[model samples]
Target: MSTTFWIIIAGAIATYLTRIGGHLVISRFDNIHPRVEAGLNAVPAAVLTTLVAPELLNAGPAEWAALVVTAVVSLRGGLMAMFLAGAAVLILARQFVG
Candidate 1:
C-alpha cells in the first residue's frame, strides 16, 4: 500500500531474480576457468568491502577499536565469534571509554 512497502517488495523480487538467474547460468557451465572461479570468489569480499569501508572510515574510536579487535580475532575464530567480540567490545568501550 505504502511507497516504502512497495519498494521493499520490488527489492525482494529483484534480489530473488538475480540469485536465480546466476544459479541458472552457472549450472549450465560444464567447466569454469580458473580465472573465472577466482573472480567469482572475490565478488563477495569486494561487495563487502564496498559496503563496509565507507562506514568504517567515519566511525568513532570505539567502533574502530572494535573493528580492529574483530579483525585480529577473525584469524582464530569463526564468524559468530568475530561478531560477538566486536559487539561486546563496542558496547563496553562506549560505556566506559566514551
Candidate 2:
C-alpha cells in the first residue's frame, strides 16, 4: 500500500481509539459533574468555529451569503434545515456570482 493509504488508516485507527477511550473512561463514573458536561456540550461549537474561522478569511460573496442564510436558519430550525438552507443559498448564489 502507498504511504498515503497507510497514513489514512493510522489516522482512522487513532480517531477510533480516542472516541472509544473517552466512552470507556466516562462510563466508569456513575455521575458526571455539571461543569464537565457543559464543557462536553460546548465541544461541537468549538469544533465548528475552528473549522469555519479559517474559511472566512478566503470566503467569497457566495460563501458569505450562504453563511448568513445558515446562521438565520439555525436560529429557527434544526441541523438538517440549517444545512439544506445554507447549501441551497450557496448553490443559487454561486450560479449568479460566479
Candidate 3:
C-alpha cells in the first residue's frame, strides 16, 4: 500500500479504538469523578462557544439575531431545534433587514 493509504488506515483505526475505549472505560465506572463529569458536561458548551465566538465578534445585525435565536433555542430545545431556529431567524433577518 501507498504510504498515504497506510496513514489513512492508521488514523481510522486509531479513531475507532479511541471511541471504543471510552465506552469500555465508562462501562466499568459505577460513577465518574466529579471533575471528570464536570469536564464532560462543559465540552458541548465550550465547543459551541468556540464555534460561535468568532462569528459573533464580526457579525452584522442579521447574524447577531440568528445567534441570539440559536442561544434561546438551545436553552429550551435540542441541537436540531436550535439549528433550525437559528437558520429560520437568519433567513427572516436577511429578507426583512436587508
Which candidate gets the maximum lDDT versus the true structure?
A: 2
CA displacement after TM-score superposition, residue 44 of candidate 1 (Å): 0.9
Task: Write out the backbone clash pairs for model 2.
Answer: none
- TM-score: which candidate is best? 1
Q: How much lDDT does candidate 2 score?
A: 0.95
Q: Which stretches of candidate 1 lie over 4 Å from their true place?
A: none
Q: lDDT per model, in order?
A: 0.92, 0.95, 0.90
lDDT of 3 by residue, 2-24 (tens): 99999999999998997898888
For model 3, what is the alpha-carbon lDDT of residue 4? 100
Clashing pairs in 3: none
Task: Compute the lDDT of residue 2 as modeled in candidate 2.
Answer: 100
Model 1 per-residue lDDT tens digits across residues 62-98: 9998999999999999999999999999999999768
Assess candidate 3 and give its lDDT: 0.90
lDDT-superior candidate, 2 or 3? 2
